[model samples]
Target: MVHHRPRTRERCPLWARRARASTPLRTLLLGLLLTLAAGPISMGATDGGGIGGTGITGFGPIQGFGSIFVNAREYFLRADTRITVDGRAAGRRALHVGDMVVVRGTADPARTTGWADVVQVRHPLVGRVDAVSAGGAHLTVLGQGVRIPAGVPVVGGDGHTVALHAGDWVAVSALANARDEWIATRVALRYPAGSVPAGVPAVIEGRVASVGPNGVLRIGTQAVRLEGAAAHKSAPAPGARIRVVGRYRDGVILASRLAPARPALGGPGRYVEMEGYAVPRAAGGLHSNGILLRPPGGKEGAGPTGIRADRALVFTGRIGPDGSLEIERMEPPHAPELPHAGAGGGERGFGGHGTHGIERPELERPRIERPELEQPRIERPEIGRPRIERPEIVRPEIEIPQAQRPEIPEVEMPGH
Candidate 1:
């Protein structure tokens, strides 16, 4: 029976024992408090927003290159923001003016200014080349300078580098640089820059080059044939800048209606601004509202209004030689297309559908059948008074009582 007694609970001071047990918990709580004192981990946020936070969004045409402008405000690009054009990944410099864009970003405290976290280009500019540099590093379109950096994708009808030239119409996809210059990423030719396709009506703006063997109006070697067209029964004088709408064939565009070009007119150092609907890319190449812009002095080669010698060639008339005038401040064509006329719509030409050209809506008359009228009828409820019947009552005979009253009455009557 030499079993050792069960070991009793250890005899220790209460506070000391409790402290020993809580050592781990106190250390953990102290570490947690220290962590709480430290602030959140930092990431770059120039406009005071985190990468995961809700951001602002906007939709409009790109107002400039380098930085995107939408809804009349400018947004600079961010490093982590996604940029896409026609569903393709693109850099900030790949954005171009007049290309419709949707942007998401975080606004600064003012909200007027902000940084763009994402941008998407919906459409590219389709137009004719105003000018091209000798080395092909730069070109002009609708008075806007486009820098063709290396690695740019240039696709011709034959597929790749079709040897760009002045007077050639082209469709450009580009981005903006830090300098705000349009850095073209894709220069696709719908046709030879200046030549129009056969059998399609288009609006053209240029000087009449010459008249050919048949009745033809030449717009810089691009002839104008007066066949199957309207309002062109008469011939336009040579060297006249006119807006002609008709089908194009064999470098000749059949003139339907020829009118004097209403260019944004200006003299040297003068500013001109014109706003109009963007013509279809399929028909009108870089001819915004059928406007033809010549050089400042009305001469293209001798213009001294561009930034570079070649860049100078882009500004319509004589404003190009020295490249002095910077008139190609493109505005966004962000007006939405309306379901009905004049509600809210895309660029409507002067005096017509918010879109381009002379279009007449078809009139239709609706035939409605008249419904027949029903005869009037009055309805009344039948109400009549109810009749009640009464029951007859009979009394028992009283002969003796009646006789006694008669005797007394007779005696009194005799005495009277």
Candidate 2:
């Protein structure tokens, strides 16, 4: 069988100026050269290179070389030596499958099978797209601009149309053109859904059925609390309508403004219609916790906040003995009988005992008794007795002598 001889290896010239060229172009040239140089050397080879005398075929494993195969003529490769494909210099040509190649080596004559060393193979140029620019459709390939042709389809991350303007990010793929730019075959955009709705502020409306210790409102299947200092007026009654303005989260709605249905009136025990979930109390009664009931027509009120009732609303089947009203069933509001005292005249107010008014009697004073005193009389002695005592008196005598003397004198005178 006739065989073509393998060519000798040739040295390639290397220069620093080649390395300084743009990155993409340099890579392309390097790949092309390698492909051409290796292509022909692989094609011209006739048999496996000669470690053994057996002829190498496409079937089974070939020995002594990295790879081997049979061509139309006799075995071409006989020994191990580096060679080139076609007439291209070694290390300067690109190689690929099905390209003509030639290998040069010492042929073994004594062996019954022909063999030669595989030195190279041939290759062809394939196009590729590298990168896209910011806010521009132009692409950089092999370090050059590649304008994208029109009518090329652009897809998003979800494989839909890439509807975006400038500054939107995307990925692109295409064919490389003469100017080193890629002719975009496809483009894809990426973004997130569920972003905040534009222009409209969030508003909620519902009835305030119950007020928590922290001032959260129990609406239908939702709890409305305030995040900031909310201007809250009289609380909405169990059946009264309310409007709220604030943020919504999880099953809880936060209120920035809590306003009752009517601004003109305020009192206790008002009935407000509300929708919410019935939370069973641990002590055996049902308490409605979170209620989500929005007002009609979505109108703004005096700083009122609430939840929408369009979604699911939960109700507890029975009200417990703890004075908490349980939802037996959820239906449109009807005329409800006001709670009153029972037939036995039981207490009227919620959880209040019966009423019976009667005054108590006054205390009496104590009485004391005194003992009587007797009078004593003494007897007087009766006696009438005359006892006379004689009086004793002593008289003096004097006048007889004087009379005698006077008579004597008269007689003497008469005598004279």
Q: Say which candidate scores most in lDDT.
A: 1
Q: Estimate the overall C-alpha local distance difference test score of candidate 1.
A: 0.49
Native-referenced Cα lDDT, model 2:
0.35
lDDT of 2 by residue, 18-120 (tens): 3577888888888888988887544332333344332221110011121232121123432333555322345322221122233323223233234444434
- Candidate 1: which stretches are off by over 4 Å? 1-186, 191-204, 212-215, 228-230, 263-416
Candidate 2: worst-modelled 10 consecutive residues by lDDT: 57-66
Candidate 1 lDDT, 1-416, residue by residue in tens: 79999989888954446565467887886687777789765554444334532245544444333355554445767678798764569876555444446676665433344567778764333445667895877887544567765545466654445667886666665433223245453566666744644464444555567866567656654556666544335677776656566655554556666666443233343322333332222222222323333333444323122222111111211223332333344433332222232443333111121221111222356788899999789888798878878877788887775445444443455655
lDDT of 2 at 249: 48
TM-score of each: 0.28, 0.17
Top-TM-score candidate index: 1
RMSD of 1: 22.3
lDDT of each: 0.49, 0.35
